[model samples]
Structure formats: C-alpha cells, structure tokens
Target: MGMNYFHQLLCRSSRWERASATQIVPWALKGLDLGDNALEVGPGYGANVATLRTRVPALTGLEIDPALAARLRTRKFDQLRVIEGDATAMPLPDTEFSSVVSFTMLHHVPTPALQDDLFAEAFRVLRPGGVFAGSDGLDRPTFRLIHLGDTCVPVPPATMTARLTRAGFTDVEVHSAATYFRFRARRPA
Candidate 1:
C-alpha cells in the first residue's frame, strides 16, 4: 500500500495513535468477543495494536508493507506476532483465528475486487462463528488531500455489506460514523 510522504508521517504520529486507541478502535470493537486468537489484517504502523493487545489474548498482525511489519517486530510487543504478507493471499492456515480485524486500513487495498479477496481471506482463516470486524475511513475531502498518490479505494458501507455477504459471511453489519465506517461479519457456526 503506497502513500504520500505526509500520509506516512500522519500514520506514525502520536496523535493518530491516541485517536485510534481512544476513538476508532474502541468504537469499532465495542461488544466484540475477539476470542483467544485474533488476526489483524493490514495493521499499518500498528496503530490499533495497543488497544487490541489489551482486548485479545493473542494478537497477530498481517501487514503488506515490509517496513511497517519489521518496525512492529522490533517493538517485541508481548503476545503479538507480526507477519509480513498480503491479506488477500495470506500465508496462514485456514480456520485459524477466532477473530479477524482491520482498522482504518481497508482503503489501501487498491481495488474493490482486491478488498473482496481480503474479505474472502478473512472468512477462510476464521474459525466457525468467528467474527471479522473493522473500521475504514470514509471518502471525504480532507482524507483525499492526505491520500494523494496513495492506493486508496474507499469501502462505502452499503457496498461493503454486499461484498461481505458475497464472501460468504453471515450477519454482516456496516455502520457509518462521522469520519469512518465500522463493519462486522460472522462466519457461520
């Protein structure tokens, strides 16, 4: 996932980390079980990892960007594993995780079709009755400015719901907030 220089800086900023911890991640994950093992797809810069680490027993991050993944690995977070790979074609095994999540990262998938492939991968890697939940920034002017020269493909809530269903997830839910959208889907038990 390519990004402008400013965009990259913003992602690594302390302000973004605080906002993700206090605002985005909590709101997106409220009431979610996240079971024993949780997988975070495209955890750019590990912004959501702090809060998620508190929520889930074991956390694994799958990142497309090698640098970001390596940086996370350097941190040596307790009970966290950083994997460098594409979410659309994961290196992990099937029915492996109790939950699959992404936060403020789906838009970097480049295309809607590839985003669907990511969804399918989530479904594939989740155990029966596992949850796939996440939040994506909405398509807006300010974000567009920051995302110039970035591979951003906004996942509109309505369209995302359809995509999740097509990926064989049941009980799909997509809710829009002021700046972003939160989605939840379940692999049938």
Candidate 2:
C-alpha cells in the first residue's frame, strides 16, 4: 500500500485510535525521567504529543507525514513544536532533548535496519543520562492482518533490547505483554 493510503487508514481506524490514545502514552513513558524537554518520533496525529506535554512541559514531535504535521501545528500547544521529518534522520541538534519517545511506530520503519537507525538517531539527540522509551506491537497473526500489505516488522522484546544495546544505549529494558512490547534505554552520562 502507498504511504498516503496507510496514513489515511491509520487516521480512520478505530484500532489505531485506541492504540494511539493519550492514556497509553503515560504507560509507555512510565518510570523514565523525561526531564523538562522531550522529543517524540512519529507521533501519528499528535495524540502522544498532547499527553507528553502534560509530563514534559517542552516537547517536539517529528512526524513523517507532512499533512499530519501541518495539522498538528495548528493546535498550537504551548511549548510544542511539530517538525515534519524522517525518524532515522531527524533535523535537530545533538544532545538537545532530555528524552526521546515513540508509541507504536517503529514497525512502520519498513526494515530492521531503518528501525535501528531510528534508535540511533534517538540516542544521538538525547542528552546524557536521558531516556529513549517506546512500545511496539508483538508479532501475531492478528497484528499482521492489521498491517496487511503495509510494512510492519513486529520486533520482539529481546530483539529490541539487543538493538538498543547495539545502538549505544545502556540500561536497556524490554517488557512484553500479550499484544505489545514496551522498552526503555538510557544514554550514558
């Protein structure tokens, strides 16, 4: 499927709505010291952005979809900036953010290599002792059907922890539940 079509499908799907809900954001970010400022990669329609702002007063969102990014900018959340960019190659300074977070978006990166790149980029942007936290769907027939023809790499918790370690993150932790996996890794100080 095309990128635009996938984006449209995500926006229309009730499942997507439930998965990207603000309530879930807190759970994904739990226990991490996000500090004062944070960055969210691939915040689909800015659902996580709204909740993240409640925790970290200063937040920036990197969205791959230009249209969605434009729409998010219209909301004009205080201390929130929406930048349209690729997750693997963010257009921001190094060690600028206190934390980096993503919610159920890594599978959309098309390949494991790209996903690793995303992890590295998150590490590159975060300050020393900062956190990189997120959650992603587990590999399952039902979850595979949800993506259908689209690109989805259901990364397991173990694999995710390895990738985080390879990407130069420390204190990696990956927790697996029934349908999804949540992870947290720290950049060394």
Candidate 3:
C-alpha cells in the first residue's frame, strides 16, 4: 500500500534523475496530443503541466497534495485546470476527457483496489477512443521496489494488459525499457 524507501533512493540518485531526463520525458510526451482535452493524475511539481497544456489547451491537473496544488496555481496557465482530488475518485463527469495520462504515480496508490479504482475512473472519464497512458518503474523481480513515495507493482506486459481489459479498455499496449513500463490503452469506439 506504500512505496518502498529503496526505490525512492534510486530515483533521487543523480544518475537515475539524469537518465530520466532523456528516457522518460520523451516517451511520456508521445502519448499526448495538443488538440485533445487531457487530464493528468498526480501532477507532481507540475513538471509536465506546462508541456501538456501546450498540446491540449484544456488540460486539467488532479493531485491529492494540497501544498503542491497551491504551488501549481502560481503559474498563469489559463488553460490549465488544477483540482485537488483522489485519482481513484475523480470529481468530473463520465466521458469528460479526450485523454488521461498518469506517470510514475501508479505505484503510489495505496493498494491494488485503489489502483483498480484509478483505472476505472480513468475509463469512466474518457470518451470512446480516448487514450490513457500511465508509466511506472516496475522492472523488478518483485513488487518490493520503491521510487520516491511510490511502490513498484511488478506489473509485466501481460498483467498490465489484463488489468486494462478488466477496466473496460481495449487495444492495450505495454511498452517498457529497463526501469520503465508504460501502459497505453484505449476505450473502444
């Protein structure tokens, strides 16, 4: 239900952070389309918020941390909508977004049930054909890996596909490299 400290240590290490700048950002950016309305979960530090808004003018950021949400307000991103809410229980209506993207936050979910809720919520909010891409550091032998305040769930490609199918998403694709795993799924039209 929580992140392992060791994984956090790995993420904070200079080498990991440096490598992420090259590996993670570009891959995450590929999932977003500027013309579509988007929703981001756990917009930590608002790092990707600016880039997201540039592509999807109606980009909404949902975070559970009040302090981070407050800091996000400092930017005059007129098109950005920042909301304080749980990813497992979003406030918006169904079919509310054209895309839903979450990165490195899946492992932070307290439990697998919560993780299921997150996937369900994302599906509920996405229009048919809407894309949902979420990435996490789970290239481990067990679910004991940790990153920052998140836990790696040891989700391989098959498991990820099954999880997406159970959540009512079709055409699931799992792309991974070393410490990164990105699950790209779509609501069927």
Top candidate, metric lDDT: 1
Evaluated against the true structure, the overall lDDT of model 2 is: 0.81
Q: Give the higher-TM-score candidate: 2 or 3.
A: 2
Q: Largest TM-score belongs to which candidate?
A: 1
| TM-score, one value per model | 0.97, 0.89, 0.80
- Where does candidate 3 stray beyond 4 Å? 1-22, 29-35, 76-79, 139-157
How many steric clashes between backbone atoms does each model show? 0, 0, 3
The order by descending TM-score is 1, 2, 3
Cα distance off (Å), candidate 1, residue 157: 1.1
Candidate models: Cα lDDT each: 0.91, 0.81, 0.74
List RMSD in Å for every model shown. 0.9, 2.4, 3.7
lDDT of 1 by residue, 1-189 (tens): 899999999999999999999999999988999999999998888888889989988999998898888888987466589889999999999999999999988889988889989999999999999999989899999878889899988888889778899999999888998898999999999
lDDT of 1: 0.91
Candidate 1 to truth, TM: 0.97
What is the Å distance of residue 63 in model 2 from its true position? 1.0
* Model 3 weakest lDDT span, ten residues long: 145-154
Cα lDDT of model 3 by residue, 17-37, tens digit: 555455565586565452378
